[model samples]
Each structure stands twice: as C-alpha cells, then as structure tokens.
Target: MAREVFDLSFSNGFARTLHERALGDIEQDYPWQSLEPSRYPPLLLARARVGWTENAFNEFCTAAAMGQMLQALVQARAPLDLIGMASRFAIDEVLHIELCARMAMRLGGGAPIHYDPEDIVFALDPSLTPLERSNELVVRLCCVGEALSFPLLSGAMRSASHPLSRSILETIVRDEAHHGKFGFLYLDWIRAELRPAERDRLGKAARQTLDAYRSLWERGPSHVVAGVTSEGFLLEHVRELGWMEASAYAELARVTIEESVRAPLARAGIML
Candidate 1:
C-alpha cells in the first residue's frame, strides 16, 4: 500500500550527488574578485563596525533556524539521502555563523545575538500540516532567504572596502548557492506529487511568503554602524538591479519562487 512507504535511504544517492555538486559549485562561483570596493561610505567605518556585529547576530539566528529544520526533517523520516545532505547543510550554516562572527570582530565590534529562539525557529504558522510545513520551510528558508541573499551579498561584496569583508561575502555567496539549490530540488520533487488544488494553495502561499520577504528586506533593521543610514543608498542600488519597480520585482520574486518551488510542486500534481 501507498508505494510501500518508500525507504528514506532510497533518496540517499540523490542527496549525495546534490551535496557534492553543491560543494563544487561554491568553489567555482567565488565572487570576491569581481567585486569592486569603491562604492562604500568612506567616513562610516564605525558604522561598518557595528553593522558587521548586527550581521553576525542575524547570521547566527539563521543558522540556528536551519539546524532546527534539518533536525525536524530527519526525525520525520525524510529520505536518508536528503537527510544526509541536510546534515551537511546544518554544519555549513553553523560555520556560516562562526564566519560571520569573525567578520564582525574584524570589523571591530561584537553585537550580541538578542533574538528570541522561538522567534527564530518556530516562526511558521502552527496550523500547517507536515507537507505544508515542508513547503513553507523550503520557500521561506531556501527560496526567499537564500535567493534574496544572493543579490544582497553581491552588493555587499562589491561595496566591501576591506579584504576580509570581501572574502567573507565571497565564501557566503558560494555556500548560499548550494542552499538555494536544495529549495529548487525539493520544490521540483514536491510539485510532481501534488494535486491541482494543492498547487494553487502553494502558489498563494508562495506569493504571501515573497511579499513578506520583500517587506523584511525593505524594513528590517539596517547594519549601518557608523551612525549613517544606508537604507536609501542600498535601496537605490537594489532599484538599479531592477528590484525597485513593483511590477518587475514582483515578477522576479514570482519567477524565483516558481522555479524553485511551484514548478516542482506542479510536477508532483500539488495544487497551486
């Protein structure tokens, strides 16, 4: 019955292949060299110093959340291959926290991570089913979180004046690409399994998440440590990258979520 409850191990090969590819991809996509350091504020070194601390705290929160999600997936009897790959991802995220901390230190400040653990880990809707939970996790954490990070980190890399900062952003970008790929693959897999109604539900869910992500990016606390607000400048740059036009940005957000989540859900016959 029910396809004999497919063994978690059955997905191991796929997970391993994807994991190894992730490593290779990161190595190949290093972005430090392409970044120019001349765009940052010259006088706000102090703010930069504080910003890095805030960044490190935020990264720590991210890593903790990822770790919890991975643990949940494993406990839910997810494919061993997927679990294994996620295990590695958990480790990678932990390292990311450490790396961000070091970067903050290099920038000359240490902002303590003050977020409530509940706020970071159980931030999702409690009413969702396991499948919905999984969908939400992949969309929020992988697609929106990591996807948005790509452009943000790229801008940061380009604006970094210090060598360490440049290297840190480069390393992060490489790892994040792999993390984003996980969302892509999982969405693909789920799409093939969902019904039409489920697919529609997913589409609505995805749109809501994207809107939330946009709001977070636009209004979230800034990292400007030197008493200078970089929000206007940062938003200006993002606009230059085509993220300012409501229609265009919405399309990009939809495309990104669809490519990583919806298409896969569709393939699986999931509604929305």
Candidate 2:
C-alpha cells in the first residue's frame, strides 16, 4: 500500500512549527565572517557579490509568494496549522537574505541591487478560481522552485570546502526540505477532488517551469549573470565555493528532475 501524503487527521493532533532550536537566531548562531580580502580573486569576489544581490531579490520574491499563498489559503478556509507554517517560512526567507548578503560581503562587497516594488507582488488571471490559483502558485513556486533547491544545494554542499558556507547552506537545505514536502502533500490532499482540467492546469505549469529551468541552465554560465562568465568555473577549484560548473549543474538539474521530481509527479498522475 502507498503511504498517505497528506495527513487527513492533521487536525486531530497539533501541527509542529519550525524547529526553532535548529534555526537559532539568524545573527547570533550564523555569525558573520571576516576573511582576508585577498583570499578570493576579483572575478570570484564579483560572483559572490552577485550571489548576494540575486539571493536578496529571491528572498523578497519568496516572501511575497508566501503572503499570497496565505491569503489564498484563508479564502479557501485551509487549516490554521498550514497557514502558520507558511508564515514561518516567510521568516526563513528573510534570514536567507542575510546569509546571502554576508557571503557576498565576505567575498568582496555587496553590489548595487535595485528592485521594483511591483515585481514582488503576486498576480493571477482574474478567471482562476481560488483553488485553481492557489494550486498553480504552490505547484510552480514551492513544488518546483523550492524542490529544486534540494538537489542544487545538496550538490553544492558536497563540493563546498568552506566550513562557514557549508554550515549556512545546510540550514537552507533543511528548511527547503519541508517546503518541497508541503507542496507534494498539499497536492496530494487535493488529489482526489481534482478534476481532469485542474490536473492539466498544474501539469502544464510544472512542465513550463521545468522547461524554463532547463533552458536557463543549458545556456551556460554566461547566462547566469551580468559581467560574470566563467563557463566551466565550478568544475574544479571553484567547487570549493560550493557551486557546480555549467555543464555539471545543467546535467545535475535535468537528472534530478527526472529522478526525484518528474517521476513522483508522473506517479501521482500529474502527467509531467
């Protein structure tokens, strides 16, 4: 017999919140570092700086998505525990911004990052029903987006030599594990009620997200950011920094989806 994904009896027992012990205080536990400025090359430092900016932006995006999801859940009368978990997840994203920024400053210094406020808000077509909109958003952002972080960060951890970076990265990996699991669980909870059309909607969304990801990865490191194009950078020495080379990262991403993500979705009858 297959295991149940969503606990139908969740309300019977109290739902657990985030592991406060593991997380600790963002600043106190994950202390900032002051490494020798000369340790990293100019390009490497520049890349780290870019990482800070990108991760900061991603932090806000994820937080914004959390708010939208919470609103949708309330409108749909979702479990209070689930909403509580999401609220906490939004806080985690904030810590991630600090972690990323610290890494950048340690590497070199933070780059100028200007983000438009409008870009942070979530929007869906007027036609989408509450359930439909929420499902698609969760499927795209959490299921696909946060799910991918598992493999990507795991791969990085394996190659990462720096003790401080690895420690911080592990927290993100731990937190994202729950995020990905929630996506699958939520989908499973709604699985029996889903019409063929709803499944198709989610299936299409997943496919599109995966395709965009593959396309982005296949484009090489030059496609990663501006003024930073070390194509095979992560193949050797840079692996010390906890990232993969262009070819390896792309292949890893594709393989991980095929194994972990795509297979599971197909089994769940999502047709991805």
Candidate 3:
C-alpha cells in the first residue's frame, strides 16, 4: 500500500460555521502569545512538533473509532442516552484533533508523517452479534485506551510549566474525563446479559488494545527526544513544551494500566 501524508483541514462557509458553533469559541483567550518557542533548542522544538502531530493523528483515529462505536450502539438498540453521549464525544475528538494540530504549528510546524489511509482504526469484527460487538468496541476504545490516556495526560499537564501548554492539556483532560469511565458505565448497564465466555473474549480484546499502546511507549526513545542522560535535566524545557520524559512517561503508563485499567476491568468482569 502506498503511504500517504497525514494531514488535516477544514471546510469554509456554512460547514465551518456549523463546526464553530459546535466547538464554541475554541481558540479564544488561549494564552497563545505566551509561547516562548525561542527558548528551546531547534531539535527539541522539532520533536515537540512531531509529538503534537502524532497526537493530532491519534485524535483523528479516535474520532473515527467513536463513529464506529456510536453506530454499533445504535444498531444494538442501546439506550437513547448512551447514543446521545457517543454523538457528543465524536465532536469532542474533532476539537481535540484541531487543538493538537494547532499546537504542532505553534512549535514550528507539524512534522511529516506517512500512513496507510486504509488502515486508520481496528475494524470491528463482523462475525459477532451486535451487542457483543458493542461490548468489544467499548472495552478496547474506552476501557483500555481512554482510561490509560486520562492520567497520562494529567501527568503531562502537571509537568507543563508553560501556560499555553498547560492550558491545552487541561482542556483535553476535561473533555476526556467521561471517556475513561464510559466503558464501566456501559458494562454496568449491560453486564447482566453478558455470558462468561463473552466476558473472557472482551478481556482479551482489552489486552490487545493495551498491548498496542504499550508497544508505542516502549519503542525505545523517540528519535528527536532519544537520549535520556542519568540526570535527564536537559529535557526540562521540553517538558514545559508539553512532553513527559521517556522514563516518566513509561512509569505513568504502568501506573495507569494497573490502577485505572486493570482494576476497573476486573470489577466489570473482564479481567485481563
């Protein structure tokens, strides 16, 4: 498959107007002018740009996944309230994508990334029943993925010294607060109908998603932020620019997986 450039854009006229209304004053008073890009080394800025670009791409993928979840819920005849909540989350992800992309531009410019457009997300298995498929989707996307991200984002937010960086992380964390718990809430509503075998399968699915994320953080160090000396003091400015050090990032990943993901998943009867 040919790799295509990963990029983002928006339409003009009424479409954009409608998007703005849904987003609601997204860029207003964001402390954008406070960014001191000059203080960081060029290499660090370039890395930050790539990091944010990766964030934007991941958000786009999540939005696509949300669409799949929303459709699955509706097909399964889920409660109207759950469907409505999923609808809202899809838009929230779009806003996040824009925010992350803009942050990349703020650092310098978004780094070039190539991806197979055909493979944006893990496709829902068609062999399963509607409700069963919904369960798998929720477990993977919300129970594991979003649950893992919430605390990691919080850690980055805490480490961010730059006001603009902190503000962006704060906004993302706020929007995603519900996402982390969405899986458990769905399970609470639907668990009575789930059989032991189905629960076991969902647990495996959750583990697959968890392992996917693990592979990312464990892929050694990023080329741009590769070296982490014993002191690790040189990356302090980079952290203010909205990145955790490699070690701190991996540690937090472990913490969130244990406390946030595994604990709740076991309670929900999908132990992994």
Candidate 4:
C-alpha cells in the first residue's frame, strides 16, 4: 500500500455494528503452552522472519479488500442480510490481522506493516454499475481468494508439526470457510441484478483470479517450493523444520484451484 490505510475508529455506524456483533462471541486464542519457537532451526526461523512477514502482508491485503467490499455493498444498495454479511466479513479480516501479526511474533517477528488506505479498497471502475463493480471484487477476493484459502490452510494445518501452529492454522481455516461462502451468497443474492455482459466480465475476472492465485503457488515467493528446495541451505532448513514437502505443498494448491475454485465457480455460472 502507498500511504493511506483504514482507521476503524472513524468507521460508519453500520461498519462499527458489524465489527461489534461479529466479535461479540469471539475470544482470542493462542497456543502459548504449546509454543517452542526456540527449538526451530535456522531455515524455519528464516521462514519465520520472511514467511511471517509475507503472511502479515497478505492479511493486510485481506483487510483492505474487506473494506472495499463494505463500500461496494452500500453502493450496490444490497439487502440487510447481505449488508450484515459484508460488515461481518470486514471484522473477520481485522481479527485475522491480529492473529497473523501475533503468529509472526511467535515466529520471531517480521517486517513492519505499511499500507495506503487508498490502495486498500478498489477504485471505481467506470465501465460497470455499482453492483457489478462490487460483484467483480467479491468474485476475486471472496470467491477465488477466500474460497481457495480454505483447502490451502487446511493442508498447511495438516502439514504443521507444531501444536501451536496447528491451532492457529485451524482457527484460520474455521474463519475462512464462512468468508469463502460469503462470495457465493452475495453472488446468489444479486444474480438478478447483473446483466449478461456483467456476468461475462465476472467470469473472465474469476478465470484471471484463478490464474493469478495459481501463479502464486507455482511462483509466488512464499508458496513456491522450487525456489528453496532446488538444492541449497533453504532446502535443508525446510526439511529440518519438518514443513510439508514442496511437491506436496504445490500439489495441494493446484488441486484446490481446480476442484474448489474452478468447479464451484462453474456451478455458480461464473465459468472459469
């Protein structure tokens, strides 16, 4: 992000309500008793320094994406239930920020987060209606991003050797399931409002999003396995941490994209 970023203190009443209600039943969870951060070798420690920083960055982006969705919801003149969902999703992202940030601390801390609020939300795309614009972003962020996140996180949880890491990953997987559904719900509710051309645009966008996320797995710094595992200190480091093998990790991402993202999107008429 450039410079501007969100400030919850200044949020509108509706946004505030969503935050309060969603967090009302929630309590922070940390596996303090299970943590053994010091036992991790240098590679996993580097994973901590670099990996946690990347996690924090993604969380920051998630928060901004949610903020954008909230604005789009209001502009789209959505019904109450969907609006409430949008509000709740915003809160979810904020909590995730806290969770990820602390996880980084547990991993031995990471780079400081910096973001521009302007960069957080989507800029208005003049070619589409308010509703269509909202749908497009939801398709990318919630539909593709959050939807795929579930399986990816679940795989990570399964691969995690540490109890505390599993706990944290589990919590994230739990939260992300709902977020993944939020896109489908929003799209379902507003299908009638969308033009055929708009749906095509969304379909195209969804495909692009799939490709983008797949690229991350195949090539993105954090998810890519080949970069570190091709033969070097990083490879030895990863093995010592008992982290999932790169082949396994990359395969998990690929399968999730094909089945979880592509198939479900086809069912939703957002064919990718």
Candidate 5:
C-alpha cells in the first residue's frame, strides 16, 4: 500500500508569511546602499554592465522554470494552500525577471533576455509523476539554485559601485532567502511521510540534483570580467567579495545544503 500523506497547510501558511515578511524587510532595510557603484574602477563598471545582463538572463530562466513547476503542482492537485504559495512565488519570480532586466538597462547593459527552450522542456517533461517532478524541481530550483544565489548576490552587492545595482541585488536576495525557506519546509513535510527506502532514494536524488549545478557557483567570471573591464580591478573586487575562493564558497554550499536542505530533511527522517 502507498504511504499516507499529510496536509501541508501549516507549512504553506508559514512559507507565505515568511515571503511576505521578507518582501517588507527588503523595502525597509535595503542593505545595498553601502556599495557606491561610482567608486569602482572603470573596468569594474564595465564588468558590472556584463554582470547585470547575465543576471537578467539567469533570472528569466529561473522565473520561467518556476512558472512551469507551479503549473505542474497545481495540475497534480497539490493542496490548495501549497498551490497558492507557489502561485505567489511564481508571480514574484516573474517580477524579478522584469526588475533585473530593467536594472541591466539602467546600468548601461543591453538586455540579453532569451529564454532557453530546454528550460521549458526540462520543467514540463511528462515522464515523471507529480511527486517525482516536484522533488526534482525543488532540488534544482530551491536547494541548489536559490540556495547558492543568495550568497553570490550578497557578495556582488557588497562590491557593487552602483547604488542602483546594490539596491536591486539586496531586494533580490530577500526574495531568494524566502524561496530557500520554502524548499526547506517542503523537504521537511515530505520527509515525514516517506519510508526508509524512499528516504534513501530521495537523498540520492537530492545530492545528484545539487551536484549537477555545482558549476553555477564555481568561480567568478574573472577572465570574462577582466576582458570587459579592461583591467583586473573588477576581478580583484570579486575576490574581495570572496568569489575567488572556492574553499569558502564550497563551505557555504555545504552549510546551506546542510542547514536549509539536508538538516531539515534529516530531522523529519528524510535520508537527504
């Protein structure tokens, strides 16, 4: 017989409230103000230009994926509460795409906002059951993707010379944090319902999903930024922000996955 599932209403409510609160905190704290973009070297400015465009492209991909995943969840007849939370998250992601695009343009970079066909194809594959799809989606979207993104953005925000870029990154970080929390909570809720064998399977799947995206957080675009900036100053700035140190970032990944993804799952008796 199949294992019984529990209602995720409370988890959904907690996630919604957390996201809402994060949105408000972003409006209030606005942590990006410390970086004065104009103070950076000219080469650094050029790098920021490229970075903004790349950032916009990444956000567009993320938003597109989240929208598709949310649709899949709704189609699977996931609890209404979870569906509603996902709906709001999808909308926020869409707005983030637009916001990042605008920020790129404002920072003197042309928008490179092409959506990859593969992103949709991977997101909407009909081969997997709903639970399988959700697990894959959360592992990639929340745990690996958003989990790594926060620290990267925070680092960029710290090194940013442009005030607007700093502000934009700060806002984006707030949303990503909440998204990470949702991934954690979902893992917790699902782990409780899984049998030992299933837990092991999920753990392996989670680790594989995470390992697949390891390159995304590998290193700064040092060479690329060097070319764009015409000097190594931007690269140095990135180094100052700790992007050059793989050890530190690797540790960050380990802790983020452990605390925000693995630990919660383990506590709920999930193998991952």
Candidate 6:
C-alpha cells in the first residue's frame, strides 16, 4: 500500500462517549484555548508540531502492536487476565494517539506525516513457536519500548512548564506504569515453557530493539533547527514548551536504557 497522510478522523459525538468510557473519570480537560502557539518562534512551533505528529503515529503503531499481542495471547491460550489486560492496553494506546494528535493541533495544527498503513506495525517471524512469538512481541513492545518510555516521559513531565503538556505526559506515564510491567508478567507466566536457547534468542531480539531506540536519540541533533544553539532565548522557549535539550535528552535515553530497560530484562532472565 502507498503511504498516506496521517489523520485522526475523529468524531465529537460517539468518540467523546467512547473516550469517557475508556478513560473513565481520570480524563481531565486540557485548556487548549490557553495555548499560545504564536508566542514561540515559528520554526520552533513547526518542529514541535512535527514531533507531536510523530508521537501520534507512534501511538497508532503501538495500538496496532497491542492488538497483535492480544490476538497472539488468545491463540496461545494465555491467562484470561493477561488477555484482558492486553485489550485494555490497546485502548490506552488509542487514547494516546488522540491526545498526541490533539497536542499537535494545539501547537498550530499537525504537521504532514505520511505513513504506510500495513507497514506501521512490527512484523514477527513466522517460524517461531506460538509462545515464542508472544514473548518476542512483548519484549520488543513492552519490555524495551514501554519500559524506556516511562522514565523518559517522567523526565519530560518534570521539565514541562506548560500545564497541557504536563497533564498529557503525566497521563501517559501513569498508564505506562502497567505497560512497562506487562512483559515481565507475561514472561513469568510462560517461563517454564521457554528453553535456554529460546531465552537467548529473545535476548538477541531485545538487543536489536534497543539499538533501534538508541538510534532515535543519536539523531536528536538533526532535529534542531538552524541558529537555535546560539540563541539562549530560543532555547528557553523550547524548554518552556516542554522539550528537553538535545544533550540532556540523549543522556537520559542512555540512562533509561540501562536502568529501566536492560536491568529489568536481565532480572526477567532475558538479558540483552
């Protein structure tokens, strides 16, 4: 399939009800009107909008990945509770997608982002056993991705001066607390079935996933617009608008990978 521009295609009537049901009373209102996108530099707003759009796309991918996990769990005859949790996780990711896209819109509308629908979700190897397949997906999505996301988002939340940005990050980090733990839960449930060789393979797969994540941080400097480095005022605006400086962001990513990701996986017997 050809790539298409990303769109939420949201509806206020039915969607509002669905959002309430999925998020319950915890879903609070954001003061979207208070956001002054014009206060920031146009280039800065442009960069932020693009980042938010990317975030929305990533959330879409995560929701799809969670759906795949839910199906795999059902096929593997995983515990009923685990399957139910996976279903809930998918709903959470979908909510995140809307939040991210709306954040982009608040920043002066979402930037153009084209994505291949079929290629958005990660593709697992068909040759793996049913149990192994579930393990790989959990490790890739939850263990590494969600685990690293928690601390990074927490840092972002702390750094966020804007109320809307802080609220969104806080909500995401709250849900991610469960998401980050899901892999170990799944692993514990299936530990008896995994052999030494299978564990080794999972470790290797996890390492590759970590490498991909690290690469994103390594590309951080490229995202910085021209001349922002020499302008202290512009840098402060970036921080106030809820973005970490490039060096700090990269350093945090490294620490998060070690403390939040690698250590947890090692404890789960899936060392990377």
lDDT of each: 0.56, 0.69, 0.84, 0.70, 0.59, 0.81
Q: 3 or 6: which has the higher TM-score?
A: 3
**Tens digits of lDDT, candidate 2, 1-272:** 33222101113333222434444655567545534546667777677667656766677678778778878877766667766776678877866766776676666666776656565655677799887877877787777877877788777777666766777788778777788777777777777888888888789889887775776357454343332435533343365455655566777787888776787777667877
Give the deviation of candidate 6 from the true structure as CA RMSD. 3.1
By summed lDDT, which 10 consecutive residues of candidate 6 come out lowest?
222-231
Give per-candidate clash totals.
27, 0, 0, 4, 3, 0
Q: Which whole-number lDDT from 0 to 100 does residue 34 have in model 4? A: 59
The local lDDT score (0 to 100) that residue 250 gets in candidate 3 is 78
Per TM-score, what order, best first? 3, 6, 2, 4, 5, 1
Residue-wise lDDT of candidate 3 within 178-242, one digit each (tens)? 88778788988998888999989998999888988876457464433344434343666867888
Models 1 onward score TM values of 0.62, 0.80, 0.92, 0.78, 0.66, 0.90
Candidate 4 stretches with Cα past 4 Å from truth are: 1-28, 112-117, 219-243
Name the candidate, 2 or 6, with the larger lDDT value: 6
Q: Model 5 Cα displacement at 263 (Å)?
A: 2.9
In terms of lDDT, the best-performing candidate is 3
Stretches > 4 Å off in candidate 1: 1-43, 125-127, 158-161, 215-272
lDDT of 5: 0.59
Question: Which ten contiguous residues of candidate 3 have the minimum total lDDT?
Answer: 222-231
Question: Residue 25 lDDT in model 3?
Answer: 73
Worst 10 residues of 5 by lDDT: 1-10
State which candidate, 3 or 4, has the greater lDDT.
Answer: 3
